[model samples]
Target: MTRIDSLRAGDPPRIGGYELAGRIGEGGQGSVFLATAPSGDQVAIKLLGSALTGGDDDPGPGFARESEILRRVAPFCTAQVIESGLLEDRPYIVSEYIDGPTLQQVVEGEGPLEGARLRRLAVGTLTALTAIHRAGVVHRDFKPSNVLLGRDGPRVIDFGIARALDAVATGSGVVGTPPYMAPEQLEGAQVEPPADLFAWGSTMVFAATGRPPFGMDSLPAIVNRILHRDPDLGLLRGDLRDLVAECLSKDAARRPTAGEALMRLLGARDRPVGFLLSAGSAAASGSPAPPHIPDSGDAPALSPGASRPPPGAGARSRARRRAAILGAGVTVALASGALVHALTRDGAPARPEATGPARPLPEVTSVPPPATTELRLPGLGTTLHENPGDTARMVSFMYDSKGGSNHYARVRGTNRFEAVAPWQEPLPSPDGTWLALLPWLKESTPQPYDFVRLVHVPSGREYIVRLTDKPLQNFNPAWSPDGTRLLLTTFDLSSGSRTPVGFAIVDAAAAKATLVRADTSGAPAAAPFAWSPGEPAVALPFGAGPRAGLRFFDLNGRTLRTADGVGEAAASESPFAPAGKRFATGCPGAFASVCVWDTATGRALARFRVPAQSAFIGWYNDAHVLLTDKSADPHKVVVMDMKGEVLRVLAEIPREEPGENRGTFLFHYMRWS
Candidate 1:
């Protein structure tokens, strides 16, 4: 259930009333020993390691002061202290050993908690703070790593005794993790409950987004941001968003009291979980529940060859003592380039250019697939019948006037479609072997917390690839010709404006991704781009920003070519022709006009005018182009030939009510079977 470390040589077998078993946890200040109490119950005894003992065999005045206060804290959503004593002038405190992972472990591995789990995490920790403050004890170092996600609820650890470390906050010495420290604490001023509340808000941000609200940085830089900058909490919403921002107020006196913050959370607990939640309520029961109860902490550390500690392992000081803490639990198998070419079009496809070096990106890995009974995904909206013999598949968040939205899947056929799982923005691979689910599909956290979830079609296995760590948004994911890589464009936020920056190429199996044609020196280019399917080049739009359209970039961040006279290619449209030689996109103005470009010559070949208020989807074939009209009763797909002739129309996808904002939501991104 949690990552446990084994005993090592030179470890003392016994300390007073406890028999030391193994090393369970190691922090900057002390080593937690998993030991047996006098009555045989398991307990964690934290003894000051040699680093803090100072080779004098005695912990100074700090230890005695810590021991006196810890004894007063009773058990109530916190680890209950059993006893504290000195052995050979060395100090140790024994408490009930909680068997769960740290809050950091849960968010880092799971990627920003949601649903009842996130609620339980919030309410439980606040309850702990209420109880701790009620007892007149302040947990100065409240952070993600210090909160243990127990099975029953969240338990705040490292509460009363952390003061023994006596680490300062001003100048060079930081008493706690800088990102979680309040402005007053960072200023080395006298701190109280408000300081801890400030840390609580920062912890909530990390629990909700897998990163600190202020972003990671050096100690000096973090202190500067803490004083001048507000947290980048664009991913959070509703009550949690407002509360976190309030607690993080730069003015110490402006921060809410712990009890006041608790009442605010309890108020939110009484209402609907808001638009950010998966459903109107958190769990199926629909009754208000404790917010932090569902945060289940999994195993600890990395298996082998992990060059770095996972998530919250880095707390307090910059230096960490590395040991064999993380054991093997789950692993991802790399199976790249096993895809069979699915479809081929007859055309004079241009020769793809020789690629340069590749950027080393982190690989996406799979977890053990969740086991469940056969799922029935019903009501997948209007199905478009494809070639009877074709095997291509499509996935959508089925929206019915009566039923609302549900995850549904169907191949391009009249065959009965079924629901596989509840996920959003599903894009099947060109080969139909895998389905890529966008992270923002089911959850409501902003783009920064989004992930690219890939599911195996046959086994229903799912893997996640974190697209970007920065507070950014992305859309329009297109699979490569081989189905091994995925292309998506990144958007940056500056002064409250979100603009497209550059296109990212993701290796699904490897879980690594890199951006192309992005401005490395200045702000990233804010424009959409589409891959040429089989080639190394991509077609991007031209806009008021750098790296805008009429430009082609290779897989590696290099600009290949640029064309003229093509309208600003929107991210919603791809330019590559079915044969992969020409580019097509909607015009820049209010009129519905389609512009096609020759990829080889960077020249406009033809321009066709269509009915107003229509979008250019893509080319069905070399001669036939596909378009969609929103004004129709049912959304109609219009097919036009290269000669500007109206060829035919396909089925319409029912439109939702006007004014409903589905961020970057489109009809579908269909890949060949």
Candidate 2:
């Protein structure tokens, strides 16, 4: 049954002296009722379904197994199992009621969490997993629905299907949801803790993308995909990709243990080392701030009057403080001296000298440019403007079609044509190193599009990256700044309607693809619009309505700032200048204007208009701008200097008859070399 179908409503009157107030949830094995005890505290009473408890034809021990596992693990993780007894000829177990919605509900309603919230969720979930694993139990069903975001943190629930590590006969009849189940589970192999790791990977995917990795409609198909298919990890950010990759490794031994996973979730590799070094420095400097050694128990309290010392005390007081600090420093040094002495020990670099009084953060202002220019492309029947700082040597390829065939041709010296290829759909890499081609009949019977070939410009070597068996129609293949990843938006026609499902990021080096997010109505996914130069975060464009704009997000899907509407309002490739201080965008149509926007604030700084309609914009050096305009007879190429003054008329092509317009003139796709 589907998840929604399993849920039961209404109260069951009474069960084992507890009054059932309402029905909370249900699953294939049992039904959970919201009930109250004599003390008025709430509890969830799970009653085994008739199918599992045993029908008239047979008697089974499903409830017995659940009770045993719950009793064993109650002390370590999950709600306290208050009692278990027979009610209405069926065994039921009551657990402490947890007040919160499931992780699945949260993601479905609010998309994904970011920044501190995402980290905290990961830590809490891993901690729960660690507790369960230490109790010698494996929670076979660990989907998002089973994880509740409690008032304090996340609490892992639904251990009803949990099994002992050594148990041989647990009556495994394909337990757990197929999308979240591990490959081994699909193979009906003996389950282990690694299975939970696989589940955690799926859970994390759901948390990040608001959906499972595999997009299957049926249970059987999902099961098949999980057994043989590799999960798409394109959308995951930062260290999450590597961590999730390790957790979902095919081999159980390769998967990290629950404890190791927890440490990774807590960023132990970065945190513990930094904490130790800072604590050491504080003690050596004679600071009263005690070393913070994080433990698995309650935090230690500071003694009364043990407040922080003033920043600049007198020399005599400083000497006394240093003596006290030296004593405390020696104590810590002796205790940790035997520990692994690594780079952070005596070899640590000395802190740099502080500069003159600290300066305030710079304010970002969106300054409009002084002027704008319009460009025209006669061959491609389009007009665009050149962005600032672009060199005149760069070229742009525009889509051109004639005689029922699609091709891309660059505008050469003046109004000349230089044919690159015979593909109608073309997506160029940011650095112009590679080109992604899509060849499909615009109007034809629907078919699955399977492969994307990436061709290196210089060597002409092609690599086919296959995403799925279904026919694929996609556009906008943008390369990440490093050129290691390619992001493409896909359109799936299998559902009869055009569903702009989502985008996938393909690791160019590995030739593997992973789905990042799904958009039902063809809206753009929250993919990074612009990658930070030599940094991990990308300027992501998102939000709804007029408030929708751009913000910076780190690789781990963490929002660095909600600086929406912070740049020129234009669509597609907002190529930043060399200094990254400015960017340019094209405004289409008759009064085609190119506007330069200041990156700091969302303001139109400058605007320059051309004689014809404009389509694309590119910068040529710091002074001249190349524009494609379609208004002048014999469409013209207009060149403008940085101050918006007309520098030169690069070229002009005579207009051709409607039918002959295909071959008379060619437009160059402009790019900076």
Candidate 3:
């Protein structure tokens, strides 16, 4: 064991063949020291605290666990663990010294980040978590202080208390900071990956507002607020509000998984609309464009009216026109100059079109005929597919203009849409009343890191379903026809390349998930995997390559069967139809064609050729599928039946501005009881 007295400042002790310079920081468990290697490179060495070292019993097991966890995660998502050993009655671990300040220090020094910068921080941190969770460990303590804002990107550190799947039984204690702990952890319940998500969410709040969601005060008060109160997200913008809200959920199961959180952040940053101008144009000395204008075709143009009278009918009219032109030009010139100045001051490249006039709105397309139309819910901003019983409704995952995580919802009657709580993955339930959400986890932790959450729409209740102990990324959740079981896909990166890890079934009501089968073959490109509604099996199209084919797997991670003759084809993005009698898959071209498959016999049923340059496919009833083609001069939404017959042309929703590409419109699924 290493002696504590020898770790004092100015004591030149050789460790790992490096001379320790001085103590940098001391904590409850260890003291960090600035050291120089044989090559003179700087590194930080942590020695166990004297409290634990002074005990008669050996405290090497804890250090051994930390070293093993670090070694397991180093290949995937952490700073390299240089060396670890024992010396003079104390054990020590040495790691490369990260130069950047901790996230806590950065936030304290710079206040809070806003706009694009905040979003970037959230994305970067979540990406780190994604890498960490893929390695099958749960980071027991994740907070701003443990994250390093390095020049390359964010790096997750301090995995001294991380727990692996096979080791969680031996790891249970109040190990993390109370304010950042998940509700379950605060309540003394067994913690899981979602606990890390809670910490991440609180950490983000600190990064954005320079204050934790639970407020900084006594530990008891902070823990109390974290357990019961909701986070105030008024200060966040873009997708951050939703992302942080999901993270700070009192119910740990409601938070999004790291992978899903990363995707939501990406979607918010890559929104369809351009950057919005600030509200006051005069204050900034610029002409702000109108937010939106209604389209009015064939309306009589209004005449230009002015107060000053002209000198003559000929000369006066000429002079008035000249004055009008000059006035418009001057406005444009001033605005352009201001914009250029602002860009230059911010060190941003100036746009050539900054001086141009705002473009006119595009002509509105003719409204499509209402075919079996149901109630319209514009307040929801997206349409919903009502269930056959009218007891539940289904809507697609959509985002609010302010940065918020996208989630699906189910509504009944005229009631407000209640968000599905637990499943952060954003996959809908078969009955369309609940959704599966993957709560976010910390990076720099080991795996099997899977957690599933279920949301009850009408009541807004969240259910936490513990799935596995191994740190694996789970997604694309689908409910079986009987509604007794839920099917999902897992992606494992433990062996290097991302492989088709496996599929599993969870008893939805009991909150028990069991692995059915796992693919031991080489890594496959991640795609949507669906369970046939009528059969007790699932189909995963391995894409076009050597391992390309529609492979079938039972619930136990075993490939029960395989089919040879589907040619080499890629899978589709949309979900499969009910009963799995017929499903749609994407095809290469300007538009994605539909390839129908017979689930019973595992054969091709029929091929529906879509309109050229189409993008998305939606089911209108069971017989007709809706296709939207935005690539043409006048975009169109065509309804095609299974016989390859074009039944009708729906009213086109016109593009907001000319030359703008709307791509495909999403028609949400709803059912009426």
Candidate 4:
């Protein structure tokens, strides 16, 4: 039976006259729900989200195109589309429900399928593709998760990005998943039936072996292999292996069509209904028992260039037109905060003038709580053993092991530690209500894809902020003080080496992004460090090569100010002070000092030289700066006053041995609201 998650707060109770039962699943474009029809039969409802179509009320041509494409495709081995309409402005489709786990889930739980089962899946999915292509529609996105193993047989689902054959030649950017995408899709070329065939081949590899044919590590490596190298088929053997290899050919023109591949698998033109699929050698092969017979429909030759005039709608270009549909709602929610704040606050002590010779530098102190192995936060309260739970303020600390360096989050004020997502680093928002997941920060190069995923800490609801219309690896994400916006540095790596593209300012609440292309001709490119607390600008270290000092950039890519004599502060949560009056950075050249600069004047205000190997860790408050003591074992997070005196220690954490090639081990904190 297919598992359905309870509906979230934002999910609609009903759509197009059907009462939604619960959520079946969610994907990049939208969420799918199990629904009850008026006739008492159960159906599946899909509400397109993200940038799929126009405003909820409009249901633009893009939505119309999707509905028409879904309606035209034959339902022999695919989910049959029942109806599609606009409900409360969002366009949704109703389709027949398939009660079973996805191919991905099944294979992951029970390992690879054997002879008859694998062969049936291939034939069934290919039949669906043949019918779809014959109907003048292309299943642009086909992969393992899209294949549902129904009790009747395997059904191909989710035509969210499908296009009528006539619209395939438009200027569509990369649209499918990286691993299963063909070379043509990666290069943004015209997609035809061969692309789906390529995906089918890749999905087969996943079913035979629990991984994509092209290794699924970094996006750049996967894309490069898809375009240049041959696929690793693993244990896939015999005639199917050769078929998949041909289907995965780099040259799309060389791949076999759905009907041709189907014929080759069946080893005949067309088998009769209920014909023994596992006869002779197939029975002797010791594979699983023969599954239900699929539609032995005639393998009609599906032409790669088949086409017909599309009905009253455009292709993905219409999606671009509706990109800002959700922008209005987000803008209204984030309109409260002021862009810039005054550096000084009322009742705050003013910085004393540099009068007598500097007093003796205060000795750094390390204070451990009752437990040496656990770090504690005063106001964090009791600990809860869950991920990003409400009322749970968690701090993530890194530890090194034989496998590698990974992060584990400890509930603030308690000794319990919890695991978040694996392989990705989670940076919590300022308010601890959201978490941004990205590739490990140690790697200079990012995975390089389209968007940044921000997960709401309390509800675990996820929102995706696309960096640009096209693919660019975005990195160095820093949350704004209010946690409503995020700043990221973008890079273009299609040509191999990472090249400075620009910066992207993302409105986390709005799911909208604006790309600002800065001048990269003068100084070497630098990652953005922090957002200005008072204004719509960001801090980036520009004191390198031909340029000197730390550069401040406004949202429009214009330089606001450049403070000389200081560089980027390593390990700093943020470079800006809470009051937006002063910023912190490392003194230019060496571990000599930490400098504080006036935000308004871009002038150095004070310099503090104390403990060795100590790095800046943002402002402890408006008047004091936080620093990490890493010169010795059992590192400590300490606070320092404006008078170059170490006031006290915040937390003392046990230091773990750094793994081979794993960079510095550090701790990060997120305060719960």
Task: Write down the worst ten-residue block by lDDT for model 1.
Answer: 322-331
Candidate 4 lDDT over 131-247, as tens digits, reads 777777678889989999886567888754445212222343567888999999899888888999999999999999999999889999999999999899998876678999999
Cα lDDT for residue 362, candidate 1: 28
Order candidates by TM-score, high to low. 3, 1, 4, 2
Give the higher-TM-score candidate: 1 or 4. 1
Top-scoring candidate (lDDT) = 4
**Each candidate: RMSD:** 20.9, 22.6, 21.7, 24.3
Query: Which model scores highest in TM-score?
Result: 3
lDDT of 1 by residue, 482-587 (tens): 7767877665432223356666666666655554435323222334556654567666656432233566666565666666445555224366765566666544
- Estimate, for each residue in 1-673, the C-alpha lDDT of model 3 and write its tens digit: 1112335654447776878876666776667777899988987787764345444254556556656666555322355567776655566777777667778888898888764346556766776676666556677688888887664346677664434212222334566787688888877787777888888888888888888888889987887787768775557764567778878777777888887786555432222111111122111222222211111111111113211111121111222332221122101000000000000001112112112112211222222233443433343332333323321123443322122334434343333444332113344444434445554222212222345655433233345454433334454455555444666665443332234556656665555566544554532444545664455666666544333456666554457676444433322322344334554544323123555555457465555555444543445444455554445434444556665566565424343332222111222333321
The C-alpha stretches of model 1 lying farther than 4 A from their native spots are 1-405, 411-414, 420-423, 441-450, 515-517, 520-526, 544-549, 570-573, 587-590, 643-646, 656-665, 669-673
State candidate 4's TM-score: 0.43
lDDT of 1: 0.56
Instruction: Give the per-residue lDDT digits (tens) of candidate 2, residues 1-673.
Output: 1122222444368898898777778677668888889899888888865455334222224445545666655332256567776665556778877777888888888888654356556656776677677667788899988887765456687664434211223243777888888889888888788999988988888787777876548987787667667777646776666888888777878998877776444323322111112122211122122222222331212123222211221111322322222212001000000000000001111222212221111332232233244455433444444334323322334332232222343322233334333322344444444545443222210112234555544344455455432323344455564455765544443333334444456665555655433223213331224443346544544554335455554544345665444333233433444345555543222124555556556455555554334323344333344554454455445556544556655544444454422331222233312
Count of steric clashes across candidates, in order? 20, 45, 60, 7
TM per candidate comes to: 0.45, 0.40, 0.51, 0.43
Task: TM-score for candidate 2, please give it.
Answer: 0.40
